[model samples]
Target: MDLRRLAVAAKPMHRTLHALPRPNCQDHAFLQMRRLATTDFSFLLPRRHAGLRSFSSTQSVPLSEVMPRDGSRADLKILPTDPDYLRLSVESMANMSRSEVSQFVFMMNSYGAVILSSSNRKEDRLAPYTMLDRLFGTPVPHDSMNEYGIVEINPANPTSINTANPIKEHLPHTDDAYTENPSMFCTLQCIQNAPSGGGETVLISGAELVAALSNKELKSLMTPGMVSLGRRPASDGSWLKVSSIPMFWVDKDSGWLQVRWRCNDGCVQSIDSAARPAYEQMDAVARHAIHQLVIPLVSGEVLIIDNRAIAHGRRSYEKGEPRIMWRKNYVGDGEIASELRNGLCPSYSSMFEGMWSMFEPKLVAV
Candidate 1:
């Protein structure tokens, strides 16, 4: 049976016994981050993957210490190169029950993308899905955060789909649904066919995007609601940029990371809020962030991402031949990890520290 089916079949729980190790400010004292000037033109893009849903399903499962069973860290560079920054782990993530895969996916989800080459082998994929079910829960929610678990078919009229603003209404988001965990990964396999812009997938990095912008623009872009002239998710009519979280946030416990800002021009939310003044403070940074990288996806392979750790979008295709890519997703534990650690550790935090003291308090012991 498919992992998704299995994860849902055996309703699992988030057992707290398997939590990730805590970071010591002394051992890994953060370095005040600053990007090189060249970082402006080519921003980082999201890795690509699925997401989790409702927190109720979490197993109280303790997040396990992140282990590198897949040795890609040294070899893998999060940037494009001649061989392509992509690597296929000799391991296949199929056939394992949802419980088994969750540990690995959870680890990878925290960092960025975990490439499963043999995932399609039918042996590796199932286990991970079940792991997700056992550790996080099942019936992963589909939202902008959890998108890609169910591939979104970009309309021929990119402008139209962009205009449709399907994400605003908060209806049936492409990837995540039911829960609000945001996506964890995207499992796609090429079916067949290639006619002009047929099945080329694209991706961008959230961390790299902000690094490209200036302090002024960065501050302004974080304005709330993501004002936009785009259509609301699943609804009609146009509104300005409207997003749930700021484009950027530096969780002291976890680290630095950018939320999903699938935003565009002429749309800016966050008109009235404490975050407003900060938004107005950044104009150039906002523009630089809006334009960033292209984590392109080719045929015969798939990419995964931690939606909370990153953001994702697709490329436009022509009509006639239908586009197809297999997709599935699951949720994670919760923000408790942030409370436990102070903040999440996305790639960006390594560069700069923000005024995140505002989020201080306590959770699982700082």
Candidate 2:
């Protein structure tokens, strides 16, 4: 075989290889061949290149269609009256059969949340964590706050602006939006219901919100670094951390829609001027009465929400009300966790690995 002729003839094959969608392990041999072919043909190239090009195997992957495989269509707007809401008795969690577990996982993926209630009126602080461990392995630690990872949501400091510490209504928001990767799931177990019949938990579907936005609005929101999330200054005038991030985006790999939102003034530090209109529009839709599911969690009930695809908050209660709850955030593990990992979306951490080093310092100063 004439080696030079073979190399020239393989030029067409190189274009075809580049056109292939993200390659699997089986395609590695072809990728290596392409690499070698490029090396062999380098002498034919001009000494002065017009622009630099990378031959690395890790070029950016094309954005996939943003449709979830778990039947959670972007257009399906969940309502308070939606019969498909996943609700199960606490007993089911304790003794879930394999098929039952599968159903539970399926519902969780489709609905972005699951509600578990017990008939007995008892206060078990450990029940929520216990059930979580049984179903999803282990809970994620709250490294900034405590060693035990469980956070007690109550009227601890009435004057504090932190939503979890005060009795005021928490507008719909994702927890830890400032961090590179917020928890994938979070659980809120009601130990004591609000006596004044307030404090219902509100959940808004991210998929539905995406479906409602106009193409222009969605594009603006999805632009990189269009929104910033961070903690406000402490009483002593010191900043914690800040992140310049996208408010909405689809993962290039899984094609799942991801959202990072903080409606609270304390966390939502800034929005780019161009994205402000779209951000405002999304906020309006998220807060609209029709788009929210108001779940009044009774005592002995635990609600698990997929933080990647749902935003959660609470209605206000009267000051000094004896309402208490246990909240735990989870990164996910085990079989159900595996399902979540492979599902349409994933935690934001994967998408912004170096975000803290790149943006945190500058944003904190601003």
Candidate 3:
């Protein structure tokens, strides 16, 4: 967590928390997939709410017909030549007075992740912060406990939110699972590499994960309500119980899916007894999907992934070996460029309790 690196201002930010009403045709994937495959529709039927129907499968807009997923897609293996790779290299960022805001947005929208090249000769890990600030105006503080916007990803000093052991495999999860808005994008700037080369970065696309699951499983996972991810005990002798969150949701405006699943957080905690099986099954499937794309990061590379669309983790390394990386989380600037990010459509909200209120029928029924 490179929490100390960001520049904070005295003036208060002008941001609003209210989100747009949930659209009728938000998630088209499950609907379309259901149409293609004759699975049980009994669980997914629309429920009458105050004499008004909530959702109907026949009304859902086809995602493929509306917006094809043919945009420039690249995973963690993105190289320099890949169009998804941001050209904000150490040299380019150093040479130019301002970061290429357009390029950053393009790469972010095209691919859920981008590999930023750092200077081999010098430690230019700090350069990405300048570029990030330009792209996303404000850096959201990691948590109330640690107010720093950036944090050094040292396994030795794991935070309370992350209690996993340093040498153990860090499971795939999005940063700040305890909040309504986790960072829209996260940067992992490599500072030091382990001598034995055991630690590797792992990334999993949420879209791909849903694609792998059956329609029934997808519908079950999207059920709205609190997921009971546990609590956050602070130093003030007070503890906050964090519960009732969703794992996967979609943008009402774009129909683009957004996922927020952390093994340590809401992924394992099922508040609803009936949904426990679905939640557990989702975790197992997510673990399977993440193993498909593992990336090795050396000392001079920074990886920026869409926090909402992709899940990331680290491989366990030897005890004596050294591994160091700086991490920073950035929320959408509400500016055009930052809003264009893959999972950050304007009406974005924590779909768990907000836009997905309509799922109460199936979610509770299960």
Query: How close is every model to the real structure, measured as TM-score?
Result: 0.48, 0.66, 0.63
- State the lDDT of candidate 1 residue by residue for 5-107, as single tens digits: 4334322211221132322211212100111111211113331221222121232211111212122221111322211334344344434444334433333
Q: Write the per-residue lDDT of candidate 2 for residues 240-269, one digit (tens) a residue.
A: 677776666555444445677777455677
lDDT of 3 by residue, 1-366 (tens): 332221121011101111122112213343223222321222223322421432323243222232212221221112122322333444544332333444444456545676767454554557666656666667877543234367776655544433334477777777766566567778887888777777787776565444444433445556556365544432332235454556665554344456776664323444576666555655675577323367777776778888887788877788756677888877767454425745622211122112233333333221
Off by over 4 Å in 1: 1-84, 96-111, 119-139, 143-193, 215-244, 251-258, 265-300, 334-350, 353-366
Q: Per model, state how many residue pairs clash.
A: 116, 1, 11
lDDT of each: 0.35, 0.58, 0.51
TM-score of 3: 0.63
Clash pairs of candidate 2?
181-349
Worst window of 10 by summed lDDT in candidate 1: 29-38
Candidate 3: C-alpha lDDT = 0.51
lDDT of 1 at 358: 21
The number of the candidate with the highest lDDT is 2
